[model samples]
Target: MTTTATPLALADVALRLRPGDHVAVATRELRRGTQVALPAADGGLVVTLPLTVPRGHKLAVRAAGAGEPVLKYGQSIGRATRDIAPGDHVHSHNLGMDDADRAYEFGTARVALPPAAVERTFRGYRRADGRWGTRNYIGIVTSVNCSASTARLIADQFRGRVLDAYPHVDGVVALTHDTGCGLVPTSDGAQVTRRTLRGYASHPNMAGLLVVGLGCEMLPVDGLLDGLALAPGTPVRRLVIQETGGIRATVRAGVAAIEEMLPAIDALRREEAPASALVLGLNCGGSDGYSGITANPALGRASDLLVAQGGTSVLAETPEVFGAEHLLLRRAVSREVGQRLLDRLDWWKGYTAAGGGTMDNNPSPGNKAGGLTTILEKSLGAVAKAGTAELVAVKEYAEPVTERGLVFMDTPGYDPVSVTGIVAGGATVVVFTTGRGSVLGCKPSPSIKVATNTETYERMREDMDLDAGRIVTGTATVEEIGEELFERVLAVASGEQTVSEELDLGSDEFVPWQLGAVT
Candidate 1:
């Protein structure tokens, strides 16, 4: 399962990421005594394998003393735990993240990309607030977990062929979550939830909205709309189960209300819009060793292209980008933006410490099996999705995205929470890259999945929208794949259905980051 195929030549046995990298990644399984030849540009060193190594695993190319830093992607991923000889497998057993810090510099490596030669456009719904949306959905937003069932019941009434006449309307989606009542109104948890709900209710993708609530909850339906701003004529309705004679009555009222609004929603039509209208959300999950090598960097290239066209691309999952924050800070447009990112990381250090954990506690079990050994390693790969665009802005979780180039949002490394914050920030289209096959979808926005390796691409063809694995197999270059992905983003923005949308898989992912104590 780890290797694509055994190579006949020693040079193809493993890949050296950078000229000075201490280790090389095994492209295929190599048995003991196999001789791996490095290219002339990489010093032309040849090492004999002392034991079998799985594909995606790393192997030392040169001898190193104990405590010496192990380098990958031209950066220190960690330190060697003990004296390591050439041809030895480099992994958790022999590496540690101790003493990984270095001098931090701000705005040193900033380089602006030239504008695209041609303008690109997509068909989208232009809202009254001057935003363009990739999809037109009618959302039933819940104020608390108490009203989740009722909201779903109401949305269920329009399931299947029920919306056959409303072709313009994508579908009715119930945005529900697990918390609403326990936390005090002023708590960070309560405020975060409220901000998320308001964002969803006002998202340009939502042509119509229905707010459903259980009257007794601390987070009431009325308060959820405090700062909401929707299209000038968008249809909206609210229902409280307790006041509307409970669940049965609320469902009937909600269904009737939506039925009345479908015609107007369906009347809205798509028009050609500039690509600058796009707000792209970037994320990665189930990552493997080829993630940075293939999909993520390709996505980063595409992000750079979008930025050239004057669009916004957001990268999230703060903890996932831990050790690599310096790379981003160096690209920050100003010291303030760089400092903002540092502040978020400092907060995370305290956040994890309070919970008796450390930043290095990532590279989850799945990540390790996929050949990632530490958070430093994972972060190095994860940041590749942002491309080389300037770090224009840094936003808090679920905060609206206002900048027009590459931006970073502070969020947990967990997929659902991270993506939820991005979508709530007004991302009309999301590009999610996965190395180990994740089928996550985000409603009110379409998710285009990119597979990192050929083996995983072939095994999970049904879920992946694009095969970035072509880069690893030598059939395509990163720029070619990046341009292809950029076109696909426009296609999806113009209403092309993604595999996740076809399977109806995004309704259960509306999880908001819950913080603070419940009182």
Candidate 2:
């Protein structure tokens, strides 16, 4: 919008919007006294109304008209739901897009990707069964809270010994959580527990795994095995802290077991494999106005390329995609996938409402500070992280994504919880986009951080790996960045260290979603 202020007005010059946008996310901090230009009839429709909006507050998107609702993201982020005047700030009080069991226009928005995938390859650790890995580590997974420390001690034994011995074996990691005990064996918690435990034990990235548990826990080690379809005790090793005599005895025996397993684990080597075997996880956090315009679309391009190569990718953060669900439904491969996605969304609405949270609670304070004002706006930008691939399947949270194409997994918008579900669902690599800077990682599966802008990347050089912000800076196009992201994924999958790995991140981020009543 054109400004009327004198020749040299330069106060917190934030995003100056044009007529097409509905909301403006704060790229820079805004103070109460900040003066901005408003839409004037004489200046024509190109002028966007401006107000002195605080960092996370919404301002009137020009006085609303009787039939005119404030638009966000160049689309109907929501509606006025009531007559509004121009220059009146818009927010939850005035606008509402309470979508309930809404049907979407599908097959109308399918983006035809460029003919085929670019020829790209990476040095990946090819498994005996031909699966590829970003890192080869021995997982010491705890099935009960009692064995948590024991698992840590077992993993710690190989931390920093003068080791030319197990160079190929990445550091052993203990995957533990606070649950897995104190629950009914037939309950959902038990089922969730079993799924998570088995997902790790048989995860493609783990070269070998040692299942640890306290024999007396309700969700005992043997019960967990019954739920999984593994060949036998041959592929994995197990230890019960109690049966091994004591902590000291268990640690000693665990070390011996790992010593025996290391040589065999090290025997696996990297080789050529089809990119289709790759299952990419689409994630976004610390977003900004530039996220959708830059990194997200770029990620979409990369996703489509992967799908074309016969690979699979998953788009998660279900609540984050609330407003943009229609966009995806339009691209659903079948009506069933679309309906299943809608069913999950319906469940979330009821669940959130019963919990006293409105959909408006979706856009985090950080998201609002970044220019997203409503769930609709935030969702639109968030889905961009998936890139434009066909909507093949939509699974419940943490459900393994076996379909070899682009799919969506239902998850809460929280970064760690969402990524954990994706990882647990069998994604070996994650490509996360950030504009405000999210320092995150998911191990066993390596994450590649792509910065949406040069500024954030420069500010946190040590944390971000690729500068997807280059797209906004004009250093590269989304296609180029997408290609770069694809290459980086393969590199990380093949064992190249992501920035998070190099900095020893991802260790504390192994949080599995605990889905049970807090009783």
Candidate 3:
């Protein structure tokens, strides 16, 4: 039989996994006693072993029956459908998953990672609000249904001209959305929508902002600033289309406002900083087999480094983590944090069921073709993107991240909506992993794509930035590649454009998750 070979030491792998973890990634095909390398550091003789079982399945220490829990990572992966032997490999052979049957031992093993005593830093824009920004941007925020065109015209006008003067600032982007009008007045949805918009309008990343509105809409332009505590200034002129006399007049006013903001925005300069200032948005799409084995795990390691350095790293995509919620709960910093995540899980269950869908309705045709079979399988793999950091907090979509460590944001699995919420929450940079190669991106906050395997990296060489394939191909361990990924984050934060962002793939991709019935 053949084996993957890595020249580096994976001796630290056990640090991230439990000793009783049933699976040992095979070092060489053996009838038995393969002497697989374990760390002599865990106070044990370093040795590896071969499985008497078939490939792709891991042995279980305890027996589990139908609808019973199968434990891996010392947590429930899913429920078993048939009786499993003590040493039987835990997989689809005897397991089935149902949301109703899923249970958790909340607060049982929640670990609070003591804040890494060392202060951290990163290359970023120091916003006036004391929040460090990963990218400097000129924001064009539309206030009413009337000023959408004016905002677009203004953004387009500054595109090339502004970039030339302020090479440090990302050029004007008109954050145009279709829902500025026709919503229930003073309703919860309207409030949340307005608050989210204001958050973006006054986001730290924006060097300057221009708010433009039409004469009227259900969401009034004049009232938009009433409750917002955010500070946005110079070049942040608000103009009403009705007062301006029409689209042509409004465009002129908008252009003048943006032009006024340009000189000041151009004067902002970048300064040396620590990596801790970086807030990383973790995402994955178009997954394949290597996603779990390589890129995602590597991305997770990078997350660990960020957290260790006092930076924030966020994990999103609620549907993708459907079956794997318990793993996160176990690592949560406290019962309250774990419970908040559980609440989101419960809401999603009811929400999807109301729409006549089940959580197991996952692992798309593409995912299955790439070797994933069920939602549980996909989630177990997807959780790797969070690394092994303790869950510090669970946040609402678009809410500011308060924790200085690993955090989770509840969001739909849809990529655009998820990324939109992420950017709205103030992530300065994003790291996306894909096995089948997703050429997706979010502007203002640039994204770096990591390929899960060598073949995908080769095929999409121009699209992917780093390859975590080295893990599976044995050229590197997840830890080594993780550090590599961490360094890449710094490079990108310092203004490197990811392949997808360079190709301008972020337009037509702004979807805010619609969470309610239209009634």
Candidate 1, 235-344: lDDT as tens digits: 89999999999999999999999999999989999999999889999999999988988999999999999999999999999999999999999999999999999999
Worst 10 residues of 3 by lDDT: 7-16
lDDT of each: 0.90, 0.74, 0.71
For model 3, the local distance difference test gives 0.71
Top TM-score hit = 1
The TM-score, computed over Cα atoms with residue i paired to residue i, of candidate 2 is 0.87
lDDT of 3 by residue, 48-133 (tens): 33334333234444446677665544545567778764434445556666455556766566555556676655567776556777
- Candidate numbers sorted by lDDT from highest down: 1, 2, 3
lDDT by residue for model 2 over 81-162, one digit each (tens)? 6765433445555676644444587667777555463655666767655566767778888888789889888877787763
The candidate, 2 or 3, that scores higher on TM-score is: 2
- Candidate 2, which segments miss by more than 4 Å at Cα? 1-19, 23-63, 66-68, 80-103, 111-119, 161-164, 227-235
**Which clashing pairs does model 1 show?**
none
Better of 1 and 2 by lDDT: 1
* Winner by lDDT: 1
